[model samples]
Target: MLSAVAGAVRFVMVAIMTVVTFITPFLGKKEGKIERKAEECKAAFAAISDTHLTDSFIRLGMFEFGLQDMAEATDRLDALVINGDITDHGYPEHWQAFTDTLLKYDISDNNIMVLGNHDTWGGDRTGDYTKENFIKYSKEATGREIDNVYFTAEINGYPVIVLGSQSDHTGPTFYQDQLDWFAEEMEKASEKGLPIFVFCHQPFNGTHGLPYNWEMEKDADPTEGGIGEHSDYILNICNQYKNVIFISGHVHAGLSNTEDGTNYSSVEKVGNVTSVNLPSYEYFDVLRHGHMVNGTGFVFEVYDGEILLRARNFATGTWLENYDVTIEIEK
Candidate 1:
């Protein structure tokens, strides 16, 4: 009877943790423990992920606070990089909705976007859209022609590479062509003796804190998460480089909890590469504990020796307070 009772208690705890993980974002409680800095720095850029813009004006309002904060923080914003998922669905109308809203805030020509799976593939989990369509709507919205899905842009004299899958689907597919292109870009950046800043919609395989890490086992399906088939090839390229800061999103993981064993901080440094996973800017269930609230992203301030990632909720115009993290840049 005692053994059975203990087992039942264990089951109940697991159930509670699961519920908390999903529902914590809706809890609406402020994170009070972390310190908030009012000062703004130079040579900083803001990055966000998983906008998942739909036709709802109510959902669109979430961007107001973040935009306002950026305007107030910096007059000449170096670049505002939207990691991916600009549209909830791969519909022209949905993409237009995102473009319309961003225009209201005047999200500048410096805005850099990396295509998310949902942006290329329809939200119905159907592979209905094409890469051409994504580029079309993107060009129409940004007024800039995207020659390739994966390309590099210079921000503050630093080379930042934006990577996306060539195929239009809601999964990470690194074709040999794309891999070759990446290697070529990395070589060029390496020749300049500059640290490469790479942004992709999907996180690399085996990255902790990302949702992909859970299913990256020996036989797990590739579409579920992570790089999947060419995981080794991708990582090999990253490892070959001396300084590669790879940023990604797609997990929609929350940023509040970093204590529990399974709950990891958004930042993880492996070898020469440091991977930072941005939490969802939309409503999605998170890992371990706490769901992420809307308008959650970091204002990355890169200094000579260190980079500070300041977490904030643009919706609320408040800093995550406790989640400000610092990473060293090898000089």
Candidate 2:
């Protein structure tokens, strides 16, 4: 009788653990499959930023629009580009949710998402954060080997570079490294007449030739004087290569507007290459993230070498701007 009781207890415990492991993380994702029976194709693709998801919620505001974006993209786009913040924090529930999501979606694992503010930094105990762990989670979840190997991928025929903020350094110094690396890459692109697009976590500069700051100062550049010492090298590099496009989130303003030749407005500099900023869909507290009104990301459609942006209109499903200008790749 004693042996039987012990056996039964052990069996129950094993079953409970198994169920918890498998059954959880079935949240945050709607059931769907890629539109194409085989696969989809397109010339270049749309840039997707700030997914900000993990598993638990049944439904949310941007769910349908995101799905629609995927469907449209799969139908017309050859690949997808994500600008980072893949996990909210690396909680068990969020990680599990993220793992099961890719497994279920049957989505392509070639997506490029950057590590953003939402992801925890080193020594961040509660968030389960750290680039190594984040890399591990992504590799395990998506079944893809990540490194400089996958950073530069060719979608369709165009080349896409996805930059990360959590490498060697997560602070302002990264900007300097990013500038050097970007300049080398841009040199090659310029020689080949190829255009490079940058998707980062923070904006390069604030609107009106200032930085998006923490204190709302008179003359602050988020890239320079906001939190950490701003990276002076980044703007210098971009000034030389104004043709390069920079798109980002964490500012919640539409595309940035700056006279410092850093922020490229779609309206002001529509023809010449421009830089853009995106809005955070999840958190939008005025005097905090935004004024609670305008808070959405910018999406870009690249054709030939011309990149066009779609403003923030989640309701109409016209998220990223459509391609308008024609690109001439001089061979």
Candidate 3:
């Protein structure tokens, strides 16, 4: 009887927290309006990662704010890619909350959500069940017939390919079949002579301050914070293609440059592939190092022979001018 009473009290406390988190955003001061920075933009999109929404209200408020900001940023967004970790755990209620929150805003209908490790970490279900849930919600959100977790979409005639881990692990695991499919997809997309945008939840091995950057340790394992055994395979495939911009978001690293100018930058290039690592979009207190600014993400604008990437703190509706980057694309 005593244990039951304690459980009831805990539930009540959680309920109160959830209610507060949902309402706090409405009461907070609204940030300045967001406007498109690119003129004559052929295609534009916003990318954010590591939302980490859960069944409770931990990051829901922040995610809601982010959606609101993005919705108001421009008149039309070709796409809004949530790179991964859409849920803290793969639970039905968690996804329900995410969809419910999305319905409250005017975010782009062309939403591309990648599957993160946290989305598959729910211990209550089998891996198949978790993937099925992902497919269901993805279809609901994008209005596409998604047979697998990994799929492709086209935004304003630009090819966008998304990759996902076949198994549920801390890092991504790509089997041979998926690798072959990726190669085929790359070949097809490259033939168009346009910049190919690839979205994955995990970064390639050692590109974005891996191992050490994973936990900020200098002597960490080489593969501690990257795609596991298949990292090299994916890297090789990406190298074979020109103008491949790979984006990922599992590290939760900050957008600040490192002191030694080595690891932890938001952007890096390996061979022909340019990798853009997104900071975790959760609350600020959850981050450990670097710029702990929460609600940070990227705005990608495609122009005639160049792609502009501007970092923005959506929570504050401010652009991070120092981190702006431009990539030249060969037509």
Candidate 4:
């Protein structure tokens, strides 16, 4: 009973905070702008994660700011990748809000939706029901027919592959079949000799300060805050390829500079793959280690043989220049 009461109070607080955030633009909050250097790139995309949209208009309004900023930034986004955790509880109402928001913004017709654990968490329905809803809405967003949660797309001639867990869990679980598919897809994507963009909701087990980064628990298991048993298997597949850029979310760890001597930065290179863990697009009080500024994500620009990642806080319309990184795509 106490826990239920605490949850109720927390919800009320969050609702109030959402309202305040929603109206910040009208209250003299200086909106940051993203300057897309279009002439300097071959392909570019905006990647964000953990929107966690619910049925509330205020929360949806908060999300709308990001989309609005992106639309205003570029004439046309080559693609927009929402890495995962799209809905708060995987309920119909939650998804309806997301669909409505997408319709309101003419941001990108090439919107790519990836599955997060929360998107499969059906509050009162079975997991399969929620997964089906994901497929339905994903088609609505991307205009592509997809039967499975994981799929691939070619955006501006660049290979973009999205991965998802077969089951709903805090940490993702990958079955053998999905693992096999991923390997095959990687092989095909690698043949182009261009930077392959991969999106997953959860990071690998130890990258980006996992376990400690997930819950701030010093003694947690290595896999506590990442992809579960198949973590190494996925890493191995990435290692086999050159110029693979892996992006993920779920930890909600904020942006940090590499000089911080912590693995919690927004970007890291594991083997042949460049790993990027995005900050949660919405604010949650559970974040630790500072840098929890909400509305944070990255814009990836592919050059001849290098990929430049620029960090931005879309909510306030600001650029996080300190977290910007440039990675050389291995030839």
Task: Write down the lDDT that model 3 would get.
Answer: 0.79
Against the reference, the lDDT scores of all candidates come to: 0.69, 0.46, 0.79, 0.80
Summarize candidate 1's per-residue lDDT along 21-126 as a digit string, tens digits.
3443445544432222334443567888987878865456665555656665544467788888877866778877877777666544577878887787664443
> How far out, in Å, is residue 299 in model 1?
0.6
**What lDDT is obtained when candidate 2 is compared to the true structure?**
0.46
User: Best-fitting candidate, measured by TM-score?
Assistant: 4
List, in order, the clash count of every candidate structure: 3, 10, 0, 3
Q: State the lDDT of candidate 2 residue by residue for 170-271, as single tens digits.
A: 332354555567667656655644565656665554432335443367555355421134433554554565456655555433333333233433223323
Between candidates 3 and 4, name the one with more favorable TM-score: 4
Top candidate on lDDT is 4
Error in Å for residue 314 of model 1: 1.4
lDDT of 4 by residue, 105-212 (tens): 777668899999998887644556766888888877667788888888987889988898777788776777789999999999988988888899999888888888
Candidate 3 residue-wise lDDT, 135-157, digit = tens = 98887666667888788898888
Which of 1 and 4 is ahead in lDDT? 4
- On a 0 to 1 TM-score scale, where does candidate 4 land against the true structure? 0.90
